[model samples]
Target: MIKQMPFVETDRLYLRGLEEEDVCDIYAYLSMEETREFLDLEQQQNIDQTWNLLYEEYLPYIEKSLFQCWVMEQKQSGKVIGHLRLYEEQQCLFVEMLLHPAYWKQGYMKEALMKMLQHVYTFLKHQNVYVKVRKENKNCIFLLESLGFQYITCVKEMLSNGKMYNMWIERLSEKEWRKQNEKNT
Candidate 1:
């Protein structure tokens, strides 16, 4: 089992493990119609369903070293506002990110993503990371591209929820990461 790591701090948010107390906050955004648009869920989820997903499905992944789900909290208010996750499968790391509507356009998601990517590259030592965004989700695609991710291809049956989305993959070798940081400095 992968022991839960400590919270990661960004400029405006904190990315930490999802605790039982985060259920209400998670459900708030997840239940919203707008939030569900690009998501794979076909139907609006009820609190009970969300709870089961968190406990039965998500928690086990955390305990088994298969996934890491984080609750994004605004540092100033200490309020849980979104969720991000990195799942490891056969030496690859896949990222999933979502932010509440209220926090949109505030750069919280980008900060969280960059911090998490750094963590995976530096601490986890993963060779590559990937994220899938619905083709209609242009904003997310732009974000990923801006972060140096390359578009792989559009997948027809990529998700079980019946959404055909484009997949973007980003590979970061230790040498590449070091050069990126050095250039930034």
Candidate 2:
């Protein structure tokens, strides 16, 4: 249902496709234990794993337009600070994001997501955008809630990684997102 990931820009960041050079920066956060705490992924063991994930997995998927993976690049530093993945299934659009710990609580993610949400609701014409967060991920829950995402329900299931956890399903309707955007502006 989705096609190419278009490049998006905000005042402080650019959301663009992934590149080989981003592997090291991606590894920097993916390898951290704290970073993986609320995520379903295991802590990345080494740089090669991140390389394989980007080259063998992410790049091919992006090329085929299977899913959209965006690299969040800081405009001032021109450095990759995070990554975002978006996909649709069964008529529901889902979004996932990760930012380096060094940039945490800096409002960079909020900026990136606002741009992405605008694209999702406006250009894509999706009625609603959804995100699933582990229940214990208070920071993520707060962020999504602040963006007008409403709590849907909670699910307890085994993830692909063979881990079981309580996951909260949250959604933001286009109308509500537009309302929130209008308030922000």
Candidate 3:
């Protein structure tokens, strides 16, 4: 097992490992149709179901070092706003995130993603990290581009709606991220 990740903090938020207690907070987003759109994830029917799903499916991610999920909480209100996930797959680190709709346009997800990128590169010593965003998710695409991620290709996915949509796979390399940060700082 890999070592547990240390808490990641930003100016307005704290990213820490998920606990069982976060089930309800997580369900708040996972149950929403808005949150499931770009992600194409299954919706949690209720809080009780969310708890069972997390306990059976995601709880291991917190215990195992190769995979991790951080619950993002606001520093002031102490409310759970989102989550950032990191896991090793196919010789690369895959990053994923979800945020409550109320927190949209607030820069909270941006800050969390930035912190995760640094951690995945600096702590995990990964050369590259990948994020797959639906082509329609302009916000995510813009965020990735702003962080120096380059578009790799578009993947076709057939969603539960039986409609085809394009998913863009973007990659950010450590060298590129460092270069951009150095130039800005």
Candidate 4:
């Protein structure tokens, strides 16, 4: 099992491990049609389904420390607004993230991801990380590009929509991220 991730904080958000109380807030986004479109998750019908997903699908792996997941809480309101999950495979880390539509375009996801990337490269000592964004998810693609991730390839992925869709695989190397960090700093 991998080590549990440490808490991460940013200017306006705190990224911490998941808790049982987070189900409701997570359901809010998972049930939204807008948020579900870009994600590969099936649209949840009710809170129970969300609970099942958390307890059965996610928590087991999380408990084993196989996957590092965090709930993004707004520092001011102390509300759970989003979540991020990651796992490493064959020396490359993979990322999955979701945020409430209400928080979209506000840089909340970017803030959380930037801090997460710092942790991955600095503390976790990962050399590279990757994320897969749907072709239609322009906002996410733009965000990844802004973070110094380069397009590796495009593949047809089966999404919640039940159809194969174009997905862009983007990768960011630690060396590249450090160079960009230096420029921005």
Candidate 2 stretches with Cα past 4 Å from truth are: 62-65
Candidate 1 colliding pairs, count: 0
Task: Please identify model 4 stretches exceeding 4 Å from their true place.
Answer: 62-65, 89-91
lDDT of 4 by residue, 57-148 (tens): 66777466567578899999888999988876566689899999999999999899988889889888888999988888999999999999
TM-score for predicted model 4 compared with the true structure: 0.93
CA-lDDT, candidates in order? 0.74, 0.87, 0.83, 0.87
| 1 or 4, greater by TM-score | 4
- Cα error, candidate 4, residue 124 (Å): 1.5
Question: Residue 3 of candidate 1: its Cα lDDT?
Answer: 43
lDDT of 3 by residue, 61-178 (tens): 6455447578898899887889877766666677888899989888888788888877777887888889888998998898889889999999897987778889898999999999
lDDT for model 3 comes to: 0.83
How many steric clashes does model 2 contain?
0
Candidate 2's residue-wise lDDT over 82-178, tens digit each? 9888877677889988998889889998999998888887788889999989999999999999999999999897987887899999999999998
Cα lDDT for residue 92, candidate 4 = 68
Question: Would you give me the overall lDDT of model 1?
Answer: 0.74
